[model samples]
Target: MRLFLCEKPSQARDIAKALGVRGKGEGCLTGAGVTVTWCIGHLLETAPPDAYDPRYKQWRLEHLPIVPEQWRMQVKPKTASQFKAVKRLLGQASEVVIATDADREGEMIARELLDHCRYRGPIQRLWLSALDDASIQKALAALRPGASTFSLYHCALGRSRADWLIGMNLSRLFTLLGQRSGYQGVLPVGRVQTPTLRLVVDRDRSIEAFQPVAWWGIDVKLEAARQVFIAQWQAPKAACDEEGRCLQQPIAEAAKAKMASAPSAQVTDVRTERMKETAPLPFDLGTLQQLCSRKFGLGAQETLDIAQALYETYKAITYPRSDCGYLPMSQHAEAPAVLAGLKRADPALVPLFDHINPGRRSRAWNDAKVSAHHGIIPTTVAPNLDKLPPRHRQVYTLIRARYLAQFLLEHSYDRTRATFECAGETLLATGKQVIEPGWKRALPEALAAQPGREPAQPLPPLARRDQCPVRDVQLKNNWTQPPKPFTEGDLISAMKNVARLVEDPKLKQKLKETTGIGTEATRAGIIQGLLDRGYLTKAGKALAATPAGCSLVDAVPRAITDPGTTAIWEQALDMVQSGEMPLEEFLARQSAWMSKLVERCKGLNVTIEGQAKAPAWKKKRKPAGARRAPAGKGRKRTAPAE
Candidate 1:
């Protein structure tokens, strides 16, 4: 019989339904000579240090670095039954189909089981993005050869081993060193999580050490014909700061007074130009998380959860873990079906439909830019809006809007800039008059405005070299503000754009090409892990690193906390994916690097001055009313107290 292995029960049912499998069996669904089994996630996990040698069970300085000579995989006890079911099917099947999440992690999930079970049968791969029936049926007909994606498994395996080496060896070496310095906490570390923690720590330090600068600004109200608009006093270069804020208070005060006394000013130049803005590309996971945090005040993990539900539970959107914001050109043919479904499911979208042109393609549809998965967009079928929970509806609305925006015209506006000579000091006024709402009409009002600034006001018509009255002059004092504390959304953006923080030119270029730091699928979890471990504290919508977190950043090697180093690893993993590097070579280098780090760090003293203490292991207390008999007094045959 042919067997199909899937990532989750929901996924198995979807694929099985398309394959005409209706019979339910032990831990699987079966019919038409095809058997489908699933893994809850990964049924197997990497074995711990103690698994190799009993002596390694106790944490000691002597056992600083534990690099496995021969790595082992153990079945997760919670999912052992499913493992058995899969193993049993593997033995009986003539051919196998691997259907899981279509990513590096997903490939690892399926291949690891195959290796452990010694499955030597012919294999195929099912690459799926959306859980909708149409997408599943389409994927079923074009199954890829197992060899096409075999390298992805090796890449994931190399990452897993490298991460393990860093986590086990470095964490042990540092925690032992910290204990001698009178600190009581296990200093756990990982390649991604530690670097992520450093981002928060560095931001917190910058905010505390900030020094505000005082400056001055002037706003003059100008009147033309019957219309009144605001104009700013232009400061001279010698008396102004780099950002054009006037540093010399006397210069600003004099300009304000002179403008106040002048009744009329000559308009030296008037320029009007039309501006066009294209529709925003649909979301990848990072951008989605960032916007949700900024607009809805949702946490990174919370946004990810809602996006996941929309993809899997409601089938309202395509895959949410995608890293690219470009859609595949082939999928453009389905736009009409998707748009029609949106109109049927939501009445509110009806008015917007009149503006959508299904034939008009946006730049978002590009073949070369598409990654492993395309952008998160609406699927061909839209679920009832009323049936979705409030948060789900909010996120779905955003996703649907971006897809709808693709077929609309560019947002067009007329920008007018007028320069004037008032009381011998230069003054400038700028205004915007919208020519067309265009794609912006698709966005909800909450997403319509720029996040940090006020929208531009329209200006009255003006002519070059015309005289205009100076209505009033207001001099304002402004201070340079400190950097705002990171919101989860802001932090997510930081992780995705980490190249901006890197100073090395070569490293910066590498980060930009590789898309910096954690993968879209794992970034939310990285943030949540920091919170759960007490490494970060959240206040309102902002995130701050705790003392323990800050100490960890200060204690670790700089390269370990450097995001560029992580990008280098990502590049190596990509090389493996392209078959340019061997998996054994990657692991061998990682092992050697691990040994060197442990040797260097083991002898150094680590100081941890943090408020949150890592709890020391405590002996279990005796159960109430079940205490042992007084020392050696009743050793013979006394009944235990109950």
Candidate 2:
């Protein structure tokens, strides 16, 4: 019998349906000589410190940095039954096919289960990008030997081990320290979470320290035949260089002062040009989260959850957890069909997609740009709206709308700018008028105006050298605002590792080569973990680090807090995936770094007094209903430290 192991039960059901398997039994579906079983997320997890040593269970500073000589794995208590079912199925089968998601984490989920279950047999890998019926059939027909997925497994294993080394060791160290300081809580820390928290804290610090300074600019307005025109200030011909950088600010200020002193101003020149803006690239996980946060007021984790549900439950979209914002070239042929599918489900988008021409030029659709998975788009399975929950339907609509818009014509608009001079002072204004609302008409909703902001008014047309009367003139004083706090949206954008923020070019380039701080799949979770541990909190859309969070980062050695450390590890992991670097080398480097960090943390003098209180995990638990005891009737009971 052939046994099929899938990442989750939903995927297994899909596979079974595709292969026409109908017989259902405990933990599996059987038919056509195939037994399909599934794992419920993670069946085996990294063993806790107590699994290494009983003494390690006690939260003592003496057991600081509980680095296991060799990591062990055990079935997670909640999923032990599922693991046993899969093990029994694997034992009875003549061969096994690994039907898991084609990604690093998914690969780890399958391999670890098999390793823990002690399954040894000829194995094959079912690799498919989408869960749609056609994609599943193709993958099954072209299944490759399981050995083909070894490199992927190696990369996944390395990632898990790296996270474990950092998460386990640091969580223990911090929790123990918090307990010693008379606080009760789990001082949760991880390789990615710590750095992510540092980002929020640092941004807050920058905003707090910012000091505003005043600056002035010359404006010009000209009148021609009852029409007004705006022109550039000219700036005494020497202040600005060829590239437009003001070589001397003082000279420019003097020039502005002189212009103000003059009685009348004259128009120097007028230039008008038309520019075209192509539609935005397709939605990747990061870009989609950013857009949803900015547009729908959705948090990063909320967006991820919505997108995941759209992908898995509704089957309305392809993979939601992708980094690349480009589709494969081969998918171009299927665009029309996919759009048609969406149109049948969403009639509102039909008009927007009617004029779509598949030959449009968009770098966002380039196949070469795609990595492990293509950008998120509607799957071949047309969304069954009747079956979708309200939230899933909304998210599915978002995916379908984006897919249709991608094939539509580019949005065209006329961008106009004018400069005017009056009383020797220069004034400038600009306006944008849509000439053609092509793909933009299909947008999910109209762009929302910011709070306290009025919609921009259109400017009237004017000619060069025209003279017009000035209705009013006034100076507007504006303070230099501090850096804005990071919303979940902004944090995700920053985490994309753009490197533009880093002043050093070398470090920036290295960051690009490493592909940002963490993979798209892990970034949101890292942020969420920080929040769950009280290292970060939400104030409206912005993320603010708690006092404990700030102090924990401040107390940690600089090496642990540096984003470059994560970047370097990412580079090494990439090399391992590509077969250019050995897993042993990467693991050795990680171990060395871990040893150094443990030593450094051991010597640090970190105190929590006056800082944020430790989490509840560190707090003592009181007896149930002890608080309800009659006053003065019973001895006061003290809660023991957790």
Per-residue error (Å), model 2, residue 75: 0.7
Alpha-carbon RMSD, each predicted model: 7.4, 7.0
TM-score, per-candidate, Cα-based: 0.95, 0.86
Which regions of candidate 2 are displaced past 4 Å?
61-65, 178-181, 215-267, 359-361, 384-394, 448-463, 501-507, 609-642
List, residue by residue over 137-244, the lDDT tens digit for candidate 2: 877899998887778877877776776666666666665566566655555555566677778989989988998754334444434455454434544445554544
Worst 10 residues of 1 by lDDT: 633-642
Q: At residue 278, what lDDT does model 1 achieve?
A: 97
lDDT for each residue of candidate 1 in 1-642, tens digit (9 for 90 to 100): 999999889889988988989999999999978999999887887776778987776678787678888989898898899999999999999998999999988898999999999999999999999999999998998999999999999988888778877877677677777879887656767777788889899899999999998899888888887898898989999998789888899989988888899998789999999999999999999999999998889998899889988988887788899999999998999999999999999998889888889998899999999989999999977989888999998999999989899989999999999999999999889999999999999999989999788899788889887888888889999999988999999998888899988888888888888778877877887777677657889999999999888988899998889888887787788888889999888888878887888888877877887744322211244321121111101101011100
TM-score of 1: 0.95
Residue 13: error of model 2 in Å? 1.0
